[model samples]
Target: MASEHLHAISADWLKSLEVASSTGDSTSFVSHFLSDGWLRDLLCFSWNFRSLSGLDKIHRFLSEVVDGKPRFEHSGLRDFKLDDHTANAPSPFKLPGPQGIEGVQGAFTFTSTKPAALGRGFFRLTQDADGKWKALTLFTDMQDLIGHEESSSDQHGLYEGRKITWEEDVEAKFRAIEADPTVLIVGGGQSGLMSAARLGRLGIRALVVEKNARVGDSWRQRTTFPKYMPKGKLANFLDSYAVDQELCVWLSSSIASTPVYNASSARWTVEVQHGDRKVIIHPKHLVLATGSGSPRIPTWNGMEEFQGALYHSDFHRDAEQSRGKRVVIVGAGNASADICEDFVAHGATEVTMVQRSATCVISSTTAEKIIFKVPFPDGTPIEELDFRYNSMPKAFVLQLQVSGGTEHVKMFDKELHDSLRKVGFRLTWESSPGSGEVGLEGFVFNRQASGTMLDVGCSKLIVEGRVKIKQGQDISHFEKDGITFKDGSKLSADVIVLATGNEPIMKTARGLLGDEITDQLSPPEVLGLDSEGEFNQVYRPSGHPGLWFASGSFEFSRPSSKHLALQILARELGLA
Candidate 1:
């Protein structure tokens, strides 16, 4: 298509949806999407994610006038107002060539039914070969606004109308155990919280145990902040720290033993210790959402002669300690960059980043272009973005998304890329799986490989030499107050911070779960794509029955959490 043609095609097409929806005309609404287009009604359809892949299902699902099971009140455009029309057109991320997709984004609020509540969603209307634009992918979900009651997402349960006091809520949840709960989720991070939320909605009693005192402590523990995520000033992390106090949780505790399974009961005996107290529980399911692992400290040839402070990235939070002192960071990843920036900001005398190899550094905003595809509202249901990125096959995703995304990334990062190169710094682009054995993006997302830093004002610091770069050399040995590298170079440092990554999930699983079960687990080097096509055995049965791993994108965890919950619910009822 010509540039002018592309320019002429805007988000004006959403006007039809607003027009069709305002009048409660189902036929007019179904006409908005192509005949073969799919409707992935996530949180909005029933709050329990559902997908309809053809025009027939789409028509039936949206047609309220016909009555029968086909009558869907919301019609995905429930209460859609033209006044809410928004245009985030000309997406930065391209669909690649061959099956080129030109998408224009629009967002609207709908009245989620089954107990009507305000809902919000993100839509992408792509132009077809016939020059007609239609709904290629529509993600609708509850706005999750204040006071929204349980709709179809929740099955009416014993806790349905019970108004329990705060004291009762805490005592009954923590102190008293329900002889046998259905599921036991370890770790109360996003995965665990969402999983508990799903299981709770499924009418299955579940408990989430976290070692930290608070529900969001897993997130709060990350003293360091991601460049792309909100930066923290006084708070621990300016990110989503979901409140899960209402959900069953035993805080300030950890797994006390290797959960034992019994053939007779078909249940597992698990133990947890909270300070001086120890608690044992029997449950039918176990979920490991404790997250990947701790900071991986690399072995340096240092003879321990250095009389300076040495620590891992996880423990390198307080930069005030390095005030007026020379600091050397031993990695080029995001944490390394953040620490370097922190040291500079905290009044450090000097900061140097030791890069062992080339690093892929992209502008922080590059994420919006590739990941968000546009300036999507932070409140826009995450399911929208999750489906857009993960709905495609792994192979096709590697081919189109990453490959095409890198091109646009290069365009957006031309200046930063040139600046990094002008300096002695070596930079590479993120990899597409089809391009090699394992690329950076695939490795991090698929193989749990080392990450590439998102340059948030750190690149400029490196370019200006305010934060110097030491490329391709390991610390051979430490002098009394400095370090000598394998490259025969020496540098003075008062402190050294190792921003090395962490061990894989298997290693963490072994230490926490038990050596016996860990030995039976898959190999560390292998990334599992179970029968359900999920990574790291998430939402699927691991080699061992009743054991599951729910780890990966914090944004996409809810969907996988739902998948895991449903699988457990099915087994509890002898369905799966």
Candidate 2:
């Protein structure tokens, strides 16, 4: 369809939505949607991330009053208009509805009066049976706090009021944060660093506490880290990012005491153990930017009787150590692929991979071209990509993926997939059951976190039989020098490396925060989709006041950092 026709359709819908929302009329508001339409709000209508499905839920969300304040009025939503940006202007889109609906999709901007904030939104409009255009999905997200716009851009070199040099100015700022941090972020990896960087731009005093001695130790310390990502190069970039962003970090530090949250002051008193000394600090908010959990090690009978070196993939840094040794890796994810390839590359005698489940395999080369090239092409500003990628609702993205995205992946990797399957590597397009996600794209969206490998060089070795495969049986037990399968087959090995992934983030949080606090968390889990099909907890509210979770890969981390910072700023300003 013509772009101008789509623009007119979007403008008309925007007008109706604005009139209904501005008047705070629930019935009129929901009249613009299909019965099963979705509304996703991020720090706009509420101080948290929420996805409401169906007209009933949307009506309740728009009409309900809490604390004697109508939720719609509390949002103070007004002035809805189509975004004028060329890239995000109204265009055609398709959804995988029962009828395979085609629709007009566009970016929009709005004003939030209650908090004095600006908001951005995206919507998909399709014709109802009566020929009236109704919304299939609408996404609203806070763009920026009015008075607290990000100020990370370069400024004049002149020291306006301070007589001291730039170094002295930054040092003083860092010291102030060290003494009285407004936000404390645990973990110094990309998630934490990005959060701190975003928070810093908003003039928030944020400190990153790293258990390691350096910024990127999380990647560097992993022995079976993927070779496609240059560890040293990324580590250097992280160190540079921390310095360039002026992020305050405490290296070789850890939480010494379980944090105590005082609701009265909305602050957390945490004890930091730096080397041998313990320092107590109080921060208004605590951000857990930690990943899912520690390396998962499955237990089998007679594990203690094994005499040879047996460890998780975390400890296998040097492939030379496996030279002339028969090694068995117990997983089929990226880590396992890397470890198996390392063993074969280093001339390990009979390196075998024990696959207990189907895996999602895609060619790394093809993935680079299909996935990263378009959205993240060279020379495009990252900030633009960040906004573009995140503006669409998760469920909408899933529809696109299921409709044709998976087919595209299958088409591109057909040859590589055929070769791997011919050699007995089982492939799957679906995520774990009940995840409600499909295909390779779904595996990533749900953060299945493992059981998928983007084949770099590992598939070639597996196809050539340099890396042997053992499949279709559960591990019965561990023998003195090897592993025994349920089929009574045994693979003799000098070393057994369990490359299984980590436990859920909630398990790790339970260990750190205890059941009392962790149990109070909403959605009941992390790293997966909630009932509303949105990521649970990460970069959003944790149900516990003054606590937040910041996680996901670099792509998610970059834009979400701003959202996290905005939430923190809103709380500090009493806008929530």
Among these predictions, the greatest TM-score belongs to 2
Across residues 1-576, which tens digit of lDDT does each residue of candidate 1 receive? 543444344336556676676666667777777775656554444423455655777677565342243446443345653223233223423454335665664455657444344565556567667978887666565543224232354222344468665556645654443556788888877778778777766667788888877666555555566444542332232113333224677678898878897868878898888668887888888888877676688775653777889888877658897899999888887778888888988899999888877676767687655545542446655655553454433443444435455565567788888888887887755443244432335545564546587777789899999999887466687787777888889878999888887777677777776777767765342243422223545655677778888776665685667666656765776644
Cα deviation at 305, candidate 1, in Å, is: 2.4
lDDT of model 2 at residue 245? Answer: 88
Q: Output the lDDT of residue 338, model 1.
A: 83
- The segments of candidate 2 whose C-alpha lies over 4 angstroms from its true place after superposition are 1-3, 67-69, 94-102, 130-132, 155-158, 223-227, 373-379, 399-408, 434-437, 445-447
Q: Name the top lDDT candidate.
A: 2
Per-residue CA lDDT of model 2 for 1-576, tens digit only, reads 887888899999899889988887768888898887878888887777788878888888877785577788767789898986746688886543234568888888999987898888888888888999998888888989998988957543557786777677788999999999999999999999999999999999999999999888887776554545687778888999898888899999999877888989778889999767899999999999876577788888999999898988876788797789999999998889988888887889888998889888888787788677755667757866666667566766676666666666678789888998898988887786754335666777675657788888888888898987889358899989998888898999898998888887888777778777887887777778776767888898889998999988888898788999999998888877
Please give the CA lDDT of all the candidate structures.
0.64, 0.83
Q: How far in Å is the alpha carbon of 65 misplaced in model 2?
A: 1.2
lDDT of 2 at 285: 92
